[model samples]
Target: MIQVRGIHKSFGEQHVLRGIDVDFHEGQCNLIIGLSGSGKTVLLKSVLGLHSVDQGTISFDGRVLGDMGKKEVKVLRQEMGMVFQGSALFNSLTIAENVRLPLDFFGDMTEAEKDERVRFCLERVRIDPESFSKTPAELSGGMQKRVAIARAIVLNPKYLFCDEPNSGLDPETAIVIDQLIHEITHEFGMTTVINTHDMNSVLEIGDHVILMEKGVKAWEGTMEEVMDSDDSAVVEYVFRSNLFKKLRAALKKA
Candidate 1:
């Protein structure tokens, strides 16, 4: 589990995250959802150690991240994996090489061992070995995202972070990616944190949901609780879509 307490962040004169407290559990997809400038990104960055927090503590299981020494921090980072919004694959590198990059940089494994690990990770993401030599440009966006996932888990990380995992894909493809990530989280028992505003994803895979507004945590709960919630701001934020509005109307009439 990942525990965050009293997280505060500031950029120049703007206070982005204010006393945010939340817990992200293993074997579950913990979602951070909000509009632009809601501090969701800042909160995610803080948890990932990409941004220095002004206050509060973040812990992985029982270990406090703020107190870790340089070597310990490096070890902790090695245990964490990230899937960026853009998929972040090198256009020049082969799919296999991209997946093997982390192992190349971090693993002490021999060449044969690295090859085996890379193949296993790619297969786990459903990317065929036949496509191993292909470049990212040759694959569709969904395929690229799969490659990114393969790379992220190549090291068998204990925690996974995904920023806007469904950014540009069609709805069906997005859900496929969502389910893929959800399955992997439970299958690996990894603590997964996804920063997104996709309402469909929130309803589909949000095991734990945190709603942010103006730099504070406006609400936190499970997917069911979020849909059932009557918090005005939350209701407005969530039911903004026509689909949800229709669902709400039907629920009321029922």
Candidate 2:
């Protein structure tokens, strides 16, 4: 599990995250949802150590992150996997090469070992190793995202952080991607954190949904509890629309 205790962060004059506290449990899809510039992204980066926290503590399974030495920090970083927005695949590299990149740079595996690991990861993401011959440009956006996921897990990291995993995809494709991620998170008991504005994903896969408003944690709950929440800010952020109304109405039992 990942825990944030009174974490505070700011950028110059902008106090982006204010005393944020939350826990992202392992084997679950923890969602950080908020409006643009509401500090959700900053909070995610803070947890990942991409940004320094002004005040607070972040721990992964009781291991404090703030006081790690250089070598210890490097080891901690090795245990993390990240999928940035836009898939972040190298344009010049083939899909297999991209997936193998992490193994080459970090894992002390022989060539044959690396190939087996790469193939295993690709198959887990529902991609054939034969398809690895193609570059990122040759695949569709959804395929690229799948490739990115494959790469993210190729090293079998313990924690996975995804920013906008379903971005730039059609609705059906987005659902597929969400399911794929949910499966992997559950299967490996990975401590997963996802930053997204996609409410559909929140409803579909969120084990814990944290609502952020103006740099503070406004609310948090599971999907079922979220559907019953009366907080206007959370409702407005997640369910205030004709479409969401239709969806909720459809979910009502006879």
Over 1-254, each residue of candidate 1 has an lDDT whose tens digit, in order, gives 99999999999999998899899998899999999999988888899899989999999998899999989889999999999998999998999999999899999999999999999999988999899999999999999999999999988999999999999999999999999999999999999999998999998999999899999999989998877789987887998988898887787788
Tens digits of per-residue lDDT for model 2 on 51-149?
999999999888899988888888888888888889999988999999999999999999999999999998899987678899999999999999999
Candidate 1 total steric clashes: 0
Off by over 4 Å in 1: 252-254
Candidate of highest lDDT: 1
How much lDDT does each candidate structure score? 0.92, 0.90
C-alpha TM-scores of all predictions: 0.96, 0.96
10 residues in a row with least lDDT, candidate 1: 245-254
